[model samples]
Target: MKVSDLDVPELLDVITKAISPVIFKGIDQDSSPHLWRERMKLHAEIVGRITAVLHCGDEVGPDIGEIIEICTRNMRAGYEQSFSEVLGPGGSLSKIRKP
Candidate 1:
């Protein structure tokens, strides 16, 4: 499904359910509203990027397999930074030249 078609709360719920006790430990009860909002925004952004990459279907676009690798192997920058790193620059996406 397109990222625009996604539901934030539902997406969060699915992720939370899928990961179990390994939850996004990035947020907590004491987290400030502003901090939590920023984190949530980042979560949405990364999800959108991943959805975009998977749907692009262009050879030059980022690979879904590689993106999964990053998600599983790297937790240093959370999700957004790591996905963006895999995507390289926005220019790289622009270089796709739709087929």
Candidate 2:
């Protein structure tokens, strides 16, 4: 099924359900301020990657496995760059975090 085939709510529901476990797992693994920032960065990277893939008109099969495969493949790419861009010296995240 293509992402466009799903209604807004259904798309959100499916994406949230699919991504929640990963978010929760990261949350469970760390509670420090630095790790919390890392987790949030990772979450943003994941959602951004998924959105990019969907936007590119990729085909997703009905099976959950296929959906996961797509998500995994997209999520694994460019993360280090994204992480550095967000958390590096003078990154936007630092500006936002500062009062």
- The lDDT values for all models are 0.48, 0.57
Residue 6 deviation, candidate 1, in Å?
Answer: 17
TM-scores for every predicted model:
0.36, 0.43
Q: Which prediction has the highest TM-score against the true structure?
A: 2
Off by over 4 Å in 1: 1-26, 58-99
lDDT of 2 by residue, 1-99 (tens): 655775645565588578757775744322444775566556656665565556445454455455555655555455556656755677654443322
Best by lDDT: 2
Clashing pairs in 1: none
lDDT accuracy of residue 36 in candidate 2: 50
Extract clashing residue pairs from model 2.
Answer: none
Local error of candidate 2 at residue 17 (angstroms):
4.2
- Distance from true location, Cα of 51 in model 1, Å: 0.3
Worst 10 residues of 1 by lDDT: 86-95
